[model samples]
Target: MAHVDSIRKDMVILEKSEFANLRTENEKMKIELDQVKQQLVNETYRIRADSKLAINLERSRVRVTDMFTDQEKQLMETTTEFTRKDTQTKSIISETSNKIDTEIAYLKTLMESNVLETVCNLAASVFTCLQ
Candidate 1:
């Protein structure tokens, strides 16, 4: 009976030691879980901030693109207007030049006719004098 009591006591002590080890392991696991939770929170915050920044950057890019598109449209319109005006001016100049050329030709024809009439009168006068 005495030997049996000693063996039971030894078993109890071993079980207690194992319980303590399990408790220590549980405490370590708790600490590790807390660290993991903290890391997850930090990562979540960083991801949210990065997402917001990306959204803002995208909005800015869209605004700049819209502005450029508007400017390009305006420039194209201005260029088209300038081309239209330039073509109109060139057409007016060409029409005026043609009218001037026509007037000059008419004046040259009148001068030639007057010169021929003068020569015929001088010949008639000379012929009368000879007679």
Candidate 2:
């Protein structure tokens, strides 16, 4: 009976040690799981921030493209208006030059006609006096 009691006591001690070791291992695994959870949360937060930044960048790109398109339209309109004004100015200058040329030609013709009439009258007077 004494021998049986000693064997039973030894078995109990060995079972308790095994239970303690299992508890320790379970605690370590729980700590590791908590660290892994925190890492996952941080990574998720970083991904969300990156997603927001990408959305803002896409919106900015769209806005800039719209602005550039509007500016290009305005530039085209301004260029068309400038072209029209330039054409009108050229027409006015051409008309003015033509009018001046016509007036100069008419005045030269009048001057030549007057000189010929004066010469004819002087020749007639000299012929009559000589006769």
Candidate 3:
């Protein structure tokens, strides 16, 4: 009977030690779970930031493209206007040159006619005086 009592006391002590070990293992497992949760949160934030950066970059590219297109349009308009003005100036110069040539020809004809009349009048006067 005494041996049976001693055996029961030993069994109780063994059970208490097992319970303590289980509690310690549970605490370690909880700490590991918390670390995993924090890592997951950090990773989620990083992904969100990367997505926002990509969106901003796309917007910037679109804006730059629009500005370049506008500039190109303005350049083309300026070139067309300059070309039109140059053509008009060339036409005016050609017309002015033609008018000057015509005026010079008319002046030469008038001078020749005057010289011939003067020679005929001088010859008639000389013939009358001799008679």
Q: What range of 10 consecutive residues in model 1 has the weakest lDDT sum?
A: 110-119
Residue-level lDDT tens digits of model 1 in 1-131:
35544755665576567556755665675576566556655655665566556556666777677756665565566556556655665675566556656755764575466457545655766686689
Candidate 2, residue 122: how far the Cα is off, in Å: 2.0
lDDT of 3 by residue, 70-122 (tens): 65565565556555655655565566556646654664565466446545655
- Give the whole-model CA lDDT for all candidates, comma-separated: 0.60, 0.60, 0.57
State the displacement of the C-alpha of residue 59, model 2, in Å, after optimal TM-score superposition: 15
List the candidate numbers ranked by lDDT, top first.
Answer: 2, 1, 3
Candidate with better lDDT, 2 vs 3: 2
Q: After superposition, how far is residue 67 of candidate 3 from its true place, in Å?
A: 2.6
Candidate 2 C-alpha error for residue 14, in Å:
99
User: Model 3: runs farther than 4 Å from truth?
Assistant: 1-63
Worst window of 10 by summed lDDT in candidate 2: 1-10
